[model samples]
Target: MKTYLPSTSYEYATVQKVAGTTITEASDVLAAEEPLEIRLGYGPAGQRQHRTLSITMRTPGHDFELTAGFLLTEGIIRSRADLTGILYCPDVAKDEERENVVRAELVPGLSLDLPRLERHFYTSSSCGVCGKTSIDAVHATSCPVLPTDGPYLDVAVVHELPARQRAAQALFEQTGGLHAAALFSPAGELLLLREDVGRHNALDKVIGAALLAEWLPLHQHVLLVSGRASFELVQKAAVAGIPIMAAVGAPSSLAVQAATNFGMTLLGFVRQQRYNVYCHGWRLVNQQPAGGPDKVA
Candidate 1:
């Protein structure tokens, strides 16, 4: 396993706490949000070139993994072999811009399709989920069909994941302002937890971390999101080949469709003793459909 480098998650802010009748001033911690610029560097030896890929509003750290995972999910690059090196640019022309930019050097001969990439942003913080509208849906290209023969999970184990994910949410506990995504083993062990201001970004962080650890094609594992499962989250999981995805909140309409079409087992409203499996029910051992004869919408 790769040892993840620790990153700071919060900054101090002054606030007023209200009681039954009195108000007390207090200092509180808040999740930090910042813009990160992603640049892709490619071509051969002396003629290497760099292009601004994207800039996103994100929490300040785990940046390299975020960019890597974003590129992969966007179909820009595949495996770790596609990268020669990744580092935060230390020499921006402006002093304040230095640490906010990361340059990913791609291996020789590979090229980026700019027109296709333009469909994503031309690269900006306002870049939508797939660069169309707000981060509302997954790009069709990002989510291909997933494997049907991935893994089986019991309903009992599915219910256990949200609590496990919640236990590792240190930043959320402190600030309550960030969304989280966690990767877990089929046995319900937490593998990785990534927190972010946006739900999509959090999933990207987790997938990116898995990629760096050479743990891609998560066929036998589960992904538990602290928030609702959106199409973007399901797409990220499908791209990473995770067989199951559970959400503490709920699944969006597009998310349910995507999960059903992609052969992924998606569940929502995971709580103490029950959870609703949205689709691909065959993968849940000893589980049955809830509604007796509800018509398929």
Candidate 2:
């Protein structure tokens, strides 16, 4: 297992020994925390103009996708085609700090609306969800229900996610405090997993990575979260076009409502070979012995 060190924390070792005897020292893993500035560039006629869009304090890795996915999920941009390029600023003098900031260049002729931009463009991993002004804002930009030809998973497939997520959770194993988001194929195979102090950031990393892979319309897969399913998580998944979502914890009221609205199947408290289907139960196969999973196409 790997460790995640917080930006400001000092790592120490614990000595193991019997009373009055010498012992061995074991290294402690610290949480990884840093500020990620998501900048944007826009211009017409093949030129580009840049602006500091927002800064989100997040765990390291996947900064490019995190920025691109954040914009897509926030409705700042619509699709991968709307992006010209996403990159980390090479001008940052510090090597460690250089990986913390990213610039996303929007396609020519595209610019964000001023009023939609936050007055203070800084967010931390601890407060991404509570920072929302209202639930209506999330609902307004929710993606339409994906076409029914979306992928389906077996009950066994759904059951394997927790363990798969656990295996990929190197950061969580070290810190024991991070949340994780994993993308799985329709067959329940883990595709990508990211850990962060904030659940939304984990999700954004996965979304961002998927976007970079040219895998938009994530309807072909499912998203699994290591924490409770919040409304914002549902909104992000819907925006990414993932048709199914599962969480190891409970679902918030708005999450269930939003999942229902977006025609996504929402599963929660998934563990120990059992789970609760809160919305769009039609997506779960073999849940009821009476018949097969519902066909929506």
lDDT top scorer: 1
Tens-digit per-residue lDDT, 41-120, candidate 1 = 88888998888888888887788889888887877777877888789887788876867899988999777777867765
Model 2 C-alpha lDDT per residue in residues 159-242, reported as the tens digit of each score? 889999998887677667788999999787888888777798889989988887889888888899999998889989988889
In model 2, state the lDDT of residue 291.
Answer: 38
Per-candidate TM-scores read 0.87, 0.81
- lDDT score for candidate 1 against the true structure: 0.78
C-alpha lDDT (0 to 100) for residue 171 of candidate 1: 76
